[model samples]
Target chain A: MDGIIEKAISLRFEIAAVILFGIGFINLLLQSNLIKKIVAFNVMDSSVFLFLASQGYIEGRMAPIVTNGVTDAANYVNPIPAGLVLTGIVVSVSVSAFFLALVQRLYKHYHTVDFDEIMMLAKERVE
Target chain B: MKKDMWKRFSAWVNGTSEERGPLELPDTAVHHEKKKLFELSDEQKIRLFKAGYLAVAAVVCLAVVSVLLYTVFQLPLFGDPNNPAVNDVVERYVEKGLEETGAVNMVAGMIIDYRSFDNFVESSVLFLAVTSVMMLLLRDKNNISREEDIQEEHERIIEKEASDLILQKVVSMVLPCIMLFGVYVVLNGHISPGGGFSGGAVMGAGLILYASAFGTDKVRELFNMKTFKTVTSTALLCYAASKAYSFYTGANGLHTGIPLGTPGAIFSSGLILVLDICVGMVVACTMYGFYVLFARGEI
Candidate 1:
């Protein structure tokens, strides 16, 4: 129980990120507005980034910058997670832009932003 | 007269008029109100169903969060040196990265040299995303002349006094600086914290700001669909070719004997700087292309 408490105290941010992920997931699942769903998706993406980057953190270490003359491993945090998060951020932006474009097209076609209304219209068209 | 100009300038910069109007309800709310006339019972039933669904979703979300929190308790503490994430591989990258890649910025060196293949794929993904967006949105023009006329008229109005004079002036002054800083970030990635992705994003934002301040036609003359396509394709191709060469050389145990110049120098990191420029080009074009396509349905 003490170990669990210590873990909880140390990984508070990660726990918060997990909660954020859950909230985003629930929002994505429950929200019918396409824009809200997109926002929720972004929230989830950011939470995952936070979790990964936090994993790479070491106390008293600077960012992975080779400063002054120091080249020791202990002087710098892990660069891998930061680099991966950078790539993830770019991918998220592109995906969000593409999704928004699709949303725009859907609005043009059905004149609505609600997923339920769009699905209803689609169903009627199919029938 | 100058004060009036300043007032008009501030208003234009703020993108709002002096006359304030009452806030209007959103279209969805208005539509729902209209639908309440005949479908009252159905709306009530739907609301009740939605409430039930929300409660269930909330409970499920709580359960998931609890499970995740429990798992978090099993994971290593934040900033623990003995954590598996701070392993031998990361240690090597942190220690010998400057010597091997000749990049002062270890993160840049690691991404652009040690893990370059991933960066290459990420750049290609940006290019692919823009291509997909273009495929989805680029419409064939049947009434070309009519569309051109409309575009011309729009441009004329935008270029005329209707456009924000102060915005145009400030963007004109700031845009070159933004572009130069972006290039600096891309070129100096080896020695600094910024890299291709960030530099490209800044450049894209500058292009977007220029397009917004001036008319799209003016910005199009500077960077249109052809320019975007050419830049993105060339950059992606170069990145893939360079990474492939490096991979082949490493696999065959052949040292290409490329000079890794002194760290903190601009041209130090053999092909990293060149690849940085390529990635920057792809990212900038993708960003600007996305904006143009989304705004006008065609670029």
Candidate 2:
């Protein structure tokens, strides 16, 4: 119990990320609107970014920017995760844009934003 | 005989005129009542199924959250230096990145130098995404010629009405500065936090602002589909070649004595600055391409 408490306290940001992930996941599943699902996907992306960034945190280190004369490993937090997150952000942007484009096409075809209605319409067409 | 029977069966299933007309119910009231009963039952069944699925989804979500929370306890504590994340590789990057890559910004160095192959692939993905979006959204000009003329007229009216004196004057004043800043960010990526992705985005935003304020025609005068294709393809090709050269030399253990010029200088990182420029071009073109394709369905 004590260890669990310590872990929770120390990993507060990670817990926050997990909470955020849960909220986004719930929204994605429960929301019927396609736009809301996209928003939930973004929320999930941010949470994952947060989790990765939090892993690189050090007790009292500066950003990975090398100051005038500082070169010590202890002076800087991990830069790998930060770089990965940067690339991930770009990927997320591209993905969201593509998804939005797809949604636009869907809207044009079905004349509705409701996923369930679209599915039913598609079923009717097939029948 | 089998084929004939199959054809007849399909026609019946598809509600052929002959079958439906001949089988018309004499007691229409009774037929209507039975149809209503089936519809009501079907609706009720669908609602029940949806509710059951929601319940199952909720349970699965709860289980996932619980499992994630439990696993969190097993991971290393936040800000612990002894964690595996801050291991030897990270230490080497922090220490040797400056001397090796000649980039003051370690993140830029790592991205452009250490993991450049990944960045190259990422830029390609962006290019491919824009291509895919274009393929999906772009309409044929000949087919929509009449619609295009109407749209153009409408756009001209909107531009005239919306782009007020103050808006035009302010955007024109700031547009050059925005473009310059983007270039500055890309060039000095090695010395600062800004790099290709951000710099390119800024430039793309500037272009978008120009298009919105002065109209796409004016923006197209400067940057159109032709320019986009040439710039993105050429930049990506150049980046791939440069990275391939470096990778080949390194893998073969041939000491290519290319100097890592003085850190903090604009031309310090031999290929990083060049790569940054290439990436910036690709990203900016993609951003603009997406906007144009989405807005007018062509570029």
Candidate 3:
């Protein structure tokens, strides 16, 4: 592989993350489907993780482990972001889990998961 | 052209109600009603209050911006009096801790010693979140699964079809293998990157498979809601009780607890076993919650 292209390939995850976020954001704004919007929210969250992990990447770095159980900082990337990512992953999962429950509740209450149907139902419920 | 004009004119003459959509209010005296110009409901009034607060906040922000601009040329306000010196001392302490522990995982030392209590608290938080979700969604599945199981079993047994045969054979073949893998992951959590949570999820996946393959009826009969709740709660309580013992007695963790045991050895972290079981239970319960809701055709 070309040197420049290899560097870009290493950054491909961050690029894909941004692209997914943008796509999901546009779809969220344009689409009237509630399920799709929820899915878009999740995609946006995932994009952050992708960007984060990419930012932590370094050329010719070892995994965040000690070489032969000795303190050698020469080959290791920062582990703070990875630890932070673990926390973020947990938060993301919890948010998705709760959101899915709410979606279930919404579907049960409103006959359809479509945004327009939900709005119509809300208007009816209000009256 | 005259006839076409006449037809269009007639429609216009009728005021084009047909052309207008249903939501379009008719411009007629009968449609008019006496109503308040700003009769806000309770929720709307609260929203209006929030809007007012936001406007106030905007003004405050602008005021702060002006103040900051006015003070731009001043030295850094509240500059740390002992900044570099304090950091120099702190770094030395951290370096000493790292050297003494002989564990290259600096973060682990920071986590276990400096902020171990915080981790215990955080673990409790996760346990709470898991428990809350289980408590909320579990009730529906417990009752519904039984009825669904019975209905499905009758259908599968009575039918002598190729698809049924295929599904039965597939499920029977795969369930044992998945279960074994899940157990392997859980048991050897301390040895590798894989741990209780991932292993538990894999185990739960096996149940999901069993449910999907053999039918919900068979799964309900085999596992049931009661079994899940009992085992899950029991597992969590047992984990908490052990932790309580450590907290009270200071007996120094469950595993072979000496100097991280030649790092990457199977018996490294003393707490890994405890961590594994807790993670496994959490994953299993969450997976079961998903399977139950989804199998109801709610998805």
Candidate 4:
């Protein structure tokens, strides 16, 4: 437990990210509002990005941008994580847009954005 | 007497007669009995299930978070250079990226040059999302109801008549600066931290501001469905073509004759700059398109 506490102190960013992920997960599970669910999904994505970015950081190193023609590997943090985070961000945005669009359609059809209400209405229609 | 009778007839015709008995509804005792027999228990069951589900979800979420936190403890220390992720691939990209990709922004070089296909696919995903959204939300004769049409028409009139003076004045001054900044970001992406995606987003935001201030009709004059389709498709096609060429040449070990001009220059990085422009265009179009489609269900 002492070692774990020491490590957690060192990896506070990761801990925060994990906590954020949990918050988003719980909200996603509990929230019935479609928009809130999308927001939670984005929160989860942001947490993952935070974790990935933290992993990429190296002490006293600059960003991946080459300055003054310095091409040394030791001078920069990991560029791969930045690139991955960029990809993740774009994908998440796309997913969010698609999800919101679907919700809008649901709102149009059922006149409600409540996930459970929509489900109930859809079932009622089917029956 | 005749006048009174005529007045009573008119009141009856207009549904103003007050003398009426209680509405005769069917026997609801059976329904009440049925509800008592089944619905009450069903409602209780649903409520119980919902509460139980939430409790379980909370427990699961806590468990997951704890497990993840524990896993984090097992991982290497944060900001440690000797971590396993800082491997040969990263080393090569950091050291040789400038010379090979001719991009001062190593992230730009890595994304648009080294892993251009992935970036291309990312752009495609954005394009696909906008397309799907348009398919779902675009107002057409088939999907639009009469009331919705009237409501939209009324909104357009309101937008036209109630154009806020302050917004117009402020946006007019700021819009040009925003457009310039967005263009600057896109143009300087290779030399700086800002690249296609961020720059495109900035430009799209400017377009949105302009639309919101001046109304969609004005924006439509310059950027309509045809313009959106043309710009996005052209950008995507250009990106695919250039990336495909580079991939083919690299595979065949043949010189593609594309000059990797000196790094840190505005017009350098071979195809990275061009690819960045293409991506910026696509992203800008997509952003504005999404706004227009969502707001007016057209565009």
The best candidate by DockQ is: 4
DockQ (C-alpha) of model 4?
0.78
Q: Can you tell me which runs of candidate 3 are displaced by over 4 Å?
A: A1-12, A65-71, B1-163, B238-262, B297-299
Model 1 residue B41 lDDT? 64
Q: Can you write out model 3's per-residue Cα lDDT over B1-299, one digit (the tens) per residue? A: 34435656787788884565333545452133212312334458757865786676556645644453333323221222222222433343234434543334444433333344543444445555555555444445543456556875666665424246677788799889998899878766544445555687799898887766666666677666677667666766766665565565455645423354554555555554555566577667657656665445321
Give TM per candidate.
Answer: 0.84, 0.89, 0.62, 0.92
Residue B37 CA displacement from its true place in model 3, Å: 19
For model 4, report the TM-score of its A chain: 0.94
Interface RMSD of each candidate, angstroms, one decimal: 1.4, 1.2, 10.4, 0.8
Query: Against the true two-chain complex, what DockQ does each candidate achieve?
Result: 0.59, 0.73, 0.17, 0.78
Top lDDT model: 4
What lDDT score belongs to each candidate, Candidate 1 first? 0.85, 0.88, 0.57, 0.91
Predicted chain A of candidate 2: TM-score? 0.94
Lowest summed-lDDT stretch of 10 residues in model 1 chain B? B17-26
DockQ category of candidate 3: incorrect
How would the candidate models be sorted by TM-score, starting from the highest? Answer: 4, 2, 1, 3
The per-residue C-alpha lDDT of model 3 at residue B210 equals 74
